[model samples]
Target chain A: MDENNLIKMELTVNGEAVSMIVKGGRRLLDFLRDDLHLTGTKEGCGEGECGSCTVHLDGQSVLACLTPMERAIGCSVLTIEGVGSPTNLHPVQAALLDEGGVQCGMCTPGMVMSALDLLERNPDPTIEEIIEGISGNLCRCTGYKKIIYGIQQAAQELQAASPAGTVKESVE
Target chain B: MLYRKYEVAQTLPEALSLLSSHNGAVVRPVAGGTDLILQLHERILSADVLVDISRVPELRGIRLENGQLVIGAATTYTEISRSDLVLKNAFVLAEASKKIGAVQIQNMATLGGNIGNASPAADAIPGLYALQADVVVCGPNAERRIPITEFHQGYRKIDLNPGELIKEIRFAIPAEGTGTAFYKYALRKSQAISVVDAAVCVQLSDGVIKHATVALGAVAPTIIRSPAAESVLIGEPPSEDLFDRAAEAACQDARPIDDIRGSAAFRKYLVGVCTSHAVRSACERAA
Candidate 1:
C-alpha cells in the first residue's frame, strides 16, 4: 500500500488525544487492537453479527468491526480498557463479578460497555430494559441470566451510592 | 485493503464531484457504514474508493416543512427512532427503526443506507412504503424524486443512478383519524433480521375504512404494497373477519422464497399472520 493513501487521524481514545496515520479502509476494531493495543475490545464476529467488538464512539455503543477507521478521525472512542481498571472497577463490572456474569469472559468487555452506555441513558432500567440493553452483546456461556442479574445489581448499587438519584462520580 | 482510498466530503457538491471523478473506479458513498462494512467484510461487495458523507451537515437532520416530514438521507436510525416529530407523525417508522438492529447497529445505520441497500428484509422500507414516502436523489447534473414504493428495482437493487446520492426522504404526515402500525417476525426479539414484516396505515371516517395501505417485507423481491389486501379494507368497516380476509389477500400478493432464515411456506404463513395483526392494531389505534 502507498503511504500517501494513509490518512492522518487525531482522536481522543480513553480520554487521551492520540494521532496516527492509518489506512482509510482499516476497521476500527483492527486499529484499536493492532495499532493501539486495546485488545480488551475483542473480535468475535468480524461481520458485526457478534458485538464482542462493541465500543463507545461519541458516547454511543457501536460495533468497531463495522466502523471504518476514518470515522474516528475527530471522534471520541471509549473502549473496555477505559471503563475501569482491574483494581478500580466500574459498578457494572463489579456487579458482574459479584453476580458471576463471567464464564468464558470473551464477551464481558462488550457486555460491560453496553451496560454502561445503557445505565448512562437509563440509570434504573428494568429487567426488560436490561435485556434489551445488552441484547447486542451475545454470550454463549453464562446463558445471559447472570448478565441480566448483574445489570440489575449494578442499577441498585449505582442508586444506593448516589442518594440524589444521580450516577456516582466514579463512573465518570 | 478493502478500499485503497477514502475521501471525506465536506459538502454535497464535493461528494458529487468525487463520485464523478471516480466514475470508472468502484466507488461507494458511505454515511453509516453498518451495512456496507458488513458487505465488504463478507466480500459480497468491494470498492476501490469509499467517499465518506457521514459528516455532511446538509444530509443529516429531521425536520417538518409544509406539513411534510423531510428526513435527511444520512440521519441515523437512532435519531429517527427517538425523534419526537417522527413519533408524532410516523410512529410506525420509528417503531420499525427501533427494530432494525440493537442499539449499536441503530446508532450507526442510516435510513438512506437501509433504502439504498434495497434488501427485501429491510425493516424500515415497509413502513416507508406504507407512509407513501418519496426519495430525493441528487447527482452532478440532475435531481429526481422517486416514490419509495417504486424505489426498489429488484433483490438488493435500487433505482439509483451512478454518481447519485440520496438527499432526503419526504412523506406527508398521517392525518387525524389515521393510524399506522408496523410488525416484524424475526428469529429473536432484537438484533435479528426479520423473517417477515408488515406495515399498515388505515384512515377511518364515520366508523368506515376510508383509506388503507398495507405493505409487506422479506416475503418478496422488494417491499411490496398489497393493493388486493388494501382494497378489502377500503370500503369495509373494521372487523376481525375483515382483517382476516385482508390478511389472506396479502398472503396471495406475497412471493416468498425459501432462504436460510425461513422456508417459503413459513414466510407465507407469517405474511398472513403479521398482516392481520398489523391491520388490527392499526385499526385499534385509529379508533
Candidate 2:
C-alpha cells in the first residue's frame, strides 16, 4: 500500500463541504470519528449487525461501519452531531430524553438517527411501524420499550409542530 | 489494511479495464460493500485493489423488457423491495428482499453482493432460483449469461471468473394463473439469518397444478431446488394431501447439517413446515 494510492474524496458533512485523502480501506465510521472528530456516532459491533453506526447517507439511513469511505465521496453525510443540538434538540432527541430512552447511551445516537429517518418517511407511523422502522437499532438497557415510546412521542410532537407533516430542519 | 487502493468506475468498460490493469493484484468489485467491508475487517477476504462499482450508473436500475423483469446487479435490496415492477411481477423476490437484514442493511446491501457472497442463508437466492432468473456477467473480452440455478458451484463458490462481474439478473414475469410466495423461518422478526427458508412458484390450470418450482435455502451447500417435490405437483390437483406429499419430498431434498443456527433435525422439520406454508400461500394467491 503506497500513500499515492489514497483516494481523494469531497463530501458535505453537517452542511460543511470538505475534502480529504482517505485510505481505500477506511470505513465511514472511522472517518467520521477520527478525521472529523464526530465521536457521537458510536461503534458498537463494528459490523452491520448492530445499528450503532447508523447515519443518513443522502437522507437514507445506512450503517457507517459497513460503508466504505469511498462511497461517501460526493455525497451528503448526516451524523448524530448534525441531527440536533443540546439546546435546540430535534423532536426525536427531545422525546427520547422525555421518555427515558437513554439507558446505556451507546445506542442512542444511532437510535435517534434511525427514528428520525423513520419519521421523515412516515410522518404518522403507528406503533408497529415505529418498531419496524427502528428494528435495526439494538438497545440492551432500555429493552426497546422506552425507545418505541420515544419514537411515538416524536411523531406526535413533529405532527403538532408542523400540521402539514414536515420534519423541521435540524441542520444549523 | 485489507485493500491498498480504491478506484471508482464510471462505466462497465472502465471497471473491466481496472480489473485487467490490476490483473495480478487481488482485485474485488465492490457494490454497496456491505458484505465486502465486513469480510475485509474480519480478515475473511483480502484485496490489493477494490474497484468501486456502486457509482456505475450502468449497473443500477429496475425495468421490464419484453415482459421480463431485468434488474441490475448493483440494485440494492431497498430498491428491489420498493420497486412496483418487482412487487407485481416477482412478488416473492420482493418479499424475500424485504426480510433481508433491516432498513440500513436493505439500503446498503445489493442483490449482486447477496448472490456473489453466496451465503446459504441468503434470503434472495431461493426466490431467484424459484423465479428462474438468469445472471449476466461481463469481462474484458466478452459477456455471458448463466442460469441462476447453475450459478453456484458450491458453498461460497460461484461460476464467476476472475475479472468478470455480474451485470444484471433477469427473469420472466410469471404468467397469468401463476402465484409465488417466499417464507423464512428465522429466530427473530427482523435482522435475523434464516434457519430455513423456502420459495414456491406454481401455476394452476383447470384446478390442476400445471407447473411448480420449490427452492430452499440454509439447508444445503447452495440454494437447492426440490425437483422431486416439483415433480409431485406437476399434474396433481391442489389439495392438503398433495401439499403434504410435496412438503415431504422437499424435506428429503434438503441436506442440512448441524450448525450454530440450528440442528440438522430442526432445519429438516422447518423445510417441511416452510415448504407447506409457501405452497399453500402460493395456491391461495393463484386462486
Candidate 3:
C-alpha cells in the first residue's frame, strides 16, 4: 500500500473509540470485517444496492460498503454485533429468532440494523411502514412476512418494557 | 482500491483548491458517495483522486435566501424530504426525494448527485425542471448560475467545467394559489429506477391557470419542458378536457427511445397519461 493513500481517522464503533491509520479508500464494511475481525456485518453485493452491509452511522442507517473511511471520521458506527449478544439479545434480535425471521441468516444482521433504526425513529410502525422500513434489506428466505411479525413483536416488547410508553434507546 | 488518493475538504474553497491543485488528474468530488462509489467499484467510472465534499459545511444545508429556497448541493434526500422549508415551499421536490429510493439510499443520496449524475430518468430532475430550479456552480476562477434546462448537455453529461463543484440548488417559492406535483413510474415501489417520471407546476388566478410547466423524464435524453403543454394550459380554466389536450400536446413534444425499461411507444403513451394526471392533481391542489 502507498503511504500517501493512508490516513488517520477517529471514530466510535460498537461503543469503542477507535483511532487508526486506514486507507482513505477503505470502506467501513472492510475496516470492520478485515481489520477488526467483526464479521457480523456481512457483505453480499459489495455494492450499495444490496443493503446487506447496512450499519448505523451516528444513529442513521447507511450502507457500509459505500461509506469510505474518510466519511467515518469523527462519527459513531454501530454494527450488528454492537446491538445484541447470544445470551441477552436486543428485543428486535430476540424477536426475530422467536418469530423465525431468520432462515439462511445472510441478511439477518443487516435486517436487524435497519429494523432498529426504523423502530428508533418510529416506535410503533404499521405493517406497511415496517415493510417500507426494511425494503432496503433484501431477504431471500422467510418471504419477509415473518420479519414483519418480528418487528411488531419487538415494538410491543419495547413498549411493555418502558412504563412511560417511550421505546428504549437502541444502543442500550 | 480503485482510487489512488483521497482527501476530505472542510470547506467549499478548500474543495475547489484541492480539485484545482490536482491539475490534469481525473479528480472527482464525492458527496454522499451513493452513485460515485458504486461506479468506481464496478469499473464504470475511474478517478485518480477523490475529494470528499460531503462534509463541507457550506454544501450541506437548506435555507430560504431572499425569495428563493436555497438547498446546499450536499444536503441528503432525507434532509430535503424532512426540511420544513422545502416541504412548505417546494412540496413536489420533497415528494420526489422520498421516491428516489428506500430509506437507506435517501439518507446517503443528495440532490446535487442526482443532477451531477444527469440520468435521464432521475426522479428529482423532473421536479427541478418543473420548479425552474437554478444550479450554482463554483470553480477556481468564478461562480456562475445555470438554468436546469441548460445544465444538462446530453446523456450522463453536464455542463460543469473541470474543478467546478455544484454549490447549491435554488428555486423561487411559487406564488400563492400555485400547486406543484410529481409522479414517477418505476419497476417497483422502492429501489427501482424511474421508467417514466412527470412533474407539473400550475398557477391559478380567477379559476384559470395563468402559468403552467410540465417536465417529463426518462422519455428523452434529458428532462424536457413541455412548452406545447404549457401553452395549452395558459388562459384555460381547470377542466378535464383542457388537461387531456395539454397532455396530448406534451406527448407530441416527447422524444423517447426504446430501452429495457419501456418501449418508446409505451413511454409516449404514458407521457400523455402521466401529464394529464399530474395536471389534474396540481389543479386540485391549486383550488
User: How closely does chain A match the true chain A in each prediction, as TM-score?
Assistant: 0.92, 0.91, 0.92
Residues A52-80, model 2: lDDT tens digits: 99999999999999888878989999999
Better of 2 and 3 by lDDT: 2
Between candidates 1 and 2, which one is better according to lDDT? 1
Give the per-residue lDDT digits (tens) of candidate 2, residues B1-287: 56788888999999988887875789899998889999999999898888999878878989999988999999999999999998888889899988999999999889999999999999999999999999999988988999998998899899999889999999999989999999999999788999999999999998888989999999999999999899989998889999899999999999999999899999999999999999998988887
How does residue B143 of candidate 2 score in lDDT? 89
Docking class of 1: medium
TM-score of 2: 0.96
lDDT by candidate, in order shown: 0.91, 0.90, 0.89
Clashing residue pairs in candidate 3 are: none
After aligning candidate 2 to the native by TM-score, how far in Å is the CA of B42 from where it should be?
A: 0.7
Winner on DockQ (2 vs 3)? 2
Top-scoring candidate (lDDT): 1
- TM-score of model 3 (first chain only): 0.92
lDDT of 1 by residue, B131-188 (tens): 9999999999988999987778888878898889998899998888998999999999
What lDDT does candidate 1 reach at residue B208? 96
Per-residue lDDT of model 3, residues B1-287, tens digit only: 86888888998899999998876889999988888888888899998888998889999999988999999999999999999998887888998898887888999999999999999999999989999999999998899999999999888889998879999998899999898888888888788888888999999999999999999999889999999999999999999899899989999899999989899999999899889988998898888
The docking category that best describes candidate 2 is medium
How far residue B1's Cα lies from its native spot in candidate 1, in Å, is 1.1
* Candidates ranked by lDDT: 1, 2, 3
DockQ of 1: 0.67
Q: List residue ranges in candidate 2 displaced over 4 A.
A: A1-5, A22-24, A165-172
